[model samples]
Target: MKTSECMLCPRQCGVDRSVKFGFCGESEEIRIARAAPHMWEEPPISGTKGSGTVFFSGCNLRCIYCQNHEIAVSHLGYAVTADKLLRIFFDLQAQGVHNINLVTAGHFAHQLIPILRQAKADGLRIPILWNSSGYESADTIRMLEGLIDIYLPDFKYINPKTAKEYSNAPDYPETAKASLAEMVRQVGAPQFDSQTGLMTRGVQVRHLVLPGHAQESRQILWYLFQTYGNGIGYSIMNQYTPMPQMKDHPLLSRKVTAQEYENVIRYAKQIGIENAYTQEGEAACESFIPKFSGQPQ
Candidate 1:
């Protein structure tokens, strides 16, 4: 399919992606950094087995301290056709994974629709999870309503200033809120498979606590708890390791302190957020980074 004026994300960089790259540095074709069984997800999603993860290349919001900068910013990956992606999904399913996780896949939503449809038709009976950066448009999210079984989105920042400083998107907070609301609307609450302890359908909001940004993480959790109540699951992340290039950037130059993470976890408990997942000490080890070894077929 030809890439028309690309407005898939809120960036709306109307570049002719058919012939050239857009602001996300991706065209109509789907480029993936990896496709493997990832065991690092939440307990319900990953379970004793793994989450079949497809790490898509490029991103709508290129955060300066992103852990996946190799794929998100540099766009270091191989392109794959929709049919090949379908095969990869089935292959992962055969590996005894609980679900198919699409990581950072917002930019390639249009291309994924067909693959998802075919996978469903072929009796690919695992939950399809859309893991995103949360800078999505409500309209774009609505388009994936039935196709997506779960929404794993980041409610990164409550302050626009922090968002713009880190991600170059001043409206990230507002847009992410609206987008998450739509996600919750589509997948109302967390439903698990009793036999396997796997998540079947739900909206899981993730917030990575940055160093010196504990208050911001608290504010984001407050907004989510107040808005969605106990209907949503939350992953309070403490795995904020400063990437190599962020050494000179003020707040991005260091890892989040134990005190910062403790404060956020304390606030989460105070707010009565029962269904939550948190990281322990030294969870930000580079060993957590998944290898981008999978290539297109």
Candidate 2:
């Protein structure tokens, strides 16, 4: 599944990654920013031990307010062979992490598939999680059918104009909707280990409430609840921290207001979103963003 034409993402730039870069700003070579235990995910994912997270470089979406701009936009990471990545997975699993979380990995799905299959064959018992921006093609998601156990995807926008203005992907609403459906089809419902309370399999859709986009957040919550009907988990995030690059921007220059977060949270409850997780107290602080050292630890 080498991405010779490089249509692995929604961009479908069609550039031969062997020669040049695609819209994701990445070549065929695998580049990773960090591989370590991450504790900031939803409780089911992070658990008490933490999720073994691998932060890949480059992104298909160009959100102006992206928190990980240093690696996503600037591509601050070192290259590693697929063999090295396989080793990193086992190393993380050995750390007793709850799961192996792959962050922003849609761009490298083709290359990572064989590695994932190999890891599972080699007795890697932990659940593999795909944490992604919602700008994914359903076809790309289909490629991950049996490989991924948990799907952690963001439902960023329900409005085309809002998606265009923020992530520069006007088709985000429809694209995310289709991809999310594919995710649900792959993982039927949420399942947890009865002993540890950690998620074992399923889809968890996350939505970060923008500072002034409370209505959009409400639309997204209502849409998820009405469409999926608690078939999947929901994470209503209140951690939209304004990056330094957005210091001059109008709407994204500041953190999400408490009222804005509360309104969305209240709407989620009113809409009968029972299987959900809501953030509380100082979640918008910059400390939540991980420090991206150039190489995997």
Top candidate on TM-score is 2
**Model 2 stretches with alpha carbons more than 4 Å out:** none
Candidate 1, residues 105-126, lDDT tens digits: the string is 9888887877888899999999
Clashing pairs in 2: none
* Highest lDDT scorer: 2
lDDT by residue (tens digit), candidate 2, 1-297: 556888888788999999999999999999999999999999989999999999999999989999899999997999989889999999999999999999999999889999999999999999999999888999989989999999999999999999989888999999999999999999978899999999999999999999888999999988888899889999999888898889999888988888888898888888888888989858888899999989657
Against the reference, the lDDT scores of all candidates come to 0.89, 0.92
Off by over 4 Å in 1: 294-297
TM-scores for all candidates?
A: 0.97, 0.98
What is the Å distance of residue 2 in model 1 from its true position? 3.5
TM-score for predicted model 1 compared with the true structure: 0.97
* Model 2 lowest lDDT segment of ten: 1-10
